[model samples]
Target: MIELSFAGWFQCRLATDPDPYDEPRGVSGYVHAYAGEPDLDRIVSFQPPPFRRTHGRDIGVAVDAVAHEGIAVPDHPLVGATVDLLDAPKFEGRNGVVADDGLEPLYPFHLQVARDDFRAARAVVPADPSFPYAELFAGGVEFGAAEIRKATGEQDLTATWAARVTALRAELADAAEPLRTAIAERLAFLTGNLGADGGGAARFFGALMRYDYVLSSEPEIDDPHGWLDATDHDEPWRASFWLGGWDADVLCGYARGTLRLPDGAGPRRSPRVPRVTDRRP
Candidate 1:
């Protein structure tokens, strides 16, 4: 599953059945793309600590050389875990719960296991009938990252990476247009009333991450490299202007992003918010 620009999601968890790689040093968790959609019957399910030894394929990626998965930009520590789908059967998700392309069910699947009798494991999201968009995104981020790594195999990470980035931005821009336009208006209002600096790009990014991106922010957050990094990786503000620049095939129907609100809150990935399964209700 490929992430849409709808939101920015990062994988932060992996749990092991044995609890072997507990608190391993220096390898602060960040998602890495897998080669193919893993065979769950054979592989372990859920997130794993770096030491939680298991096959990469079992980690829910399609096993192909060109599969390309996107990890967190500034990889953060493991705050979440990949657990047994059986343990998490209630379907608290967004990925495997797919919008069908045709008659085929594009259910978002996770590859946490591989049973010997089963040939096709549930690689996409489970068949949960009612989950919020947030759950689908959460599962798909891990799966999509693996798919991305497979899709992008060694090709130019920069250009190819940029394409996915643009796709995500477009998705987000479309989803967030209401919030974006609203924030722009809010900033304008703040600029008129308070000092212009009060609602500058800093405020924009802060609020953008909050209302538009759904990211949690802190003034004292540390970044050894600041704008220079975002310049290399992060899409520019103008990306919103160019709508159709991303390569279409690269999109895997799964995307990760933030759900920014105009409340002067913070930025967060999809899972942080409340995900109700029965949305249509």
Candidate 2:
């Protein structure tokens, strides 16, 4: 006597007993792909006594039945039936979530099934391009160091740093209005704190390049300072100060109409001016 179980998101059952179990079984293994459909009636016919019954079946049901039989059921209507166990894809850490494909960096949700299973299943396309992270960065606001590396052999650190700064400046010049101003101000603050001489700029730029890639990709990210903490730098307070200045400049830009708001986002309220505190000696 062979016992089989079919388990997944879809509901299904195959049992030799006349009265099949009411509850669905828990998913035990990763999803798999099979060559052909299972013949429920033929499979039930093979079983002794009460005979098996299939209810709300899926591909998993056929795979489970084939595994139990231990031999191919060639005579059944569905021919060349075979189960092909699929391998899982590689997942890398992005933002705070683990994802396989290069989806929106800020999308925190993920779904995984075997390759073969996915190919056989229906493909669902998202209606909006910025789903999952749409509400977070609706304005498409993105900033951080731009790519300024040249693969022209090895060069002196000072020369390399100068070239990078020049490239960054050129990129900023092409940016739209106040966004350019916001980025330029932030970059100046960062470089000034790190210092231009004594390899400080080079060290900071290296860290900035890596960190900025992650930051720019994740448009929905809320805490810029938090992400900047991942950079390889001893003075984390620099990042905090830089982010504060960047946010202030961006908000002011929006208020001044130099920067445009996201679609459907109403006009921004005027930024509150800080009151000067009087101190007497």
Candidate 3:
């Protein structure tokens, strides 16, 4: 078993075929472990493993061999964290890969930490001072414009729509305390991705409204997941917004009026909002 000790973060990526004609020959994905302090800037600079003909298959095997025992991180909050690979539901037609009688093959695999450890890891990693918006939102702005053009058959109207988005942001500012901050953070997450578009943002905003309505009407209820489910969004989308690390707890805190923004921490404009041209379609 190979043991790794580090203070940085872990990310997982699925292995892809180097040759279209040949079958996949080994374990499914790679667990990229970086060695550094948990600071984002420093951790992002660590080099990833070089590409290999086997797609890091041997690395995958080494990880899987110790899955039951789990990887140990000495002196870290996530010490004794259990490590495991994401599993597929069933084997498809990939040759040379065998699925146990009832188990699925680990195709398109990547590393996943147990829920408790994941929360702990995220908790210690200092929140990016920017909180929600980051460089990634620039890409989202372009993708959003393209999506708008596709749906409305209109010429690129991102400038006009961006104005509307700005108006929405301004309106949200007057919303009651704590809830205002919560909504801002949630909106940032919803709109901070390449897949984000105006429609999705609108829908998510509506869902947030509905969530507020539920909490107001039924003050005794403590179920954020149930309220999200009633909003009619897909499970994965809901999970991404509500269950990703501390989001659910944060939402519940807002509902219970227990969440408080630290002094000097609340919604603030990004230093610069990149122009649509700043990102390619």
- Count of clashing residue pairs in every prediction: 85, 0, 0
Taking every candidate in turn, the Cα RMSD to the unseen true structure, in Å, is 23.3, 30.7, 24.6
On a 0 to 1 TM-score scale, where does candidate 2 land against the true structure? Answer: 0.18
lDDT scores of the candidates, listed in order: 0.24, 0.23, 0.23
Q: Which candidate gets the maximum lDDT versus the true structure? A: 1
Cα lDDT tens digits, model 2, 101-137, are 2221212211111222121111112224443232111
Ranking by lDDT: 1, 2, 3
Candidates 1 and 2 compared: the better one by lDDT is: 1
Report the error of model 2 at residue 174, Å. 5.2
- Give the clash total for candidate 2: 0
lDDT of 2 at 213: 11
Candidate 3 lDDT, 22-122, residue by residue in tens: 22221222111112212111111111323321111122111111111244424433333333323221122122232111121212222232324132101
lDDT against true structure, model 1: 0.24
Worst 10 contiguous positions by lDDT, candidate 1: 236-245
TM-score between candidate 1 and the true structure? 0.19
| Model 3: per-residue Cα lDDT at residue 19 | 21
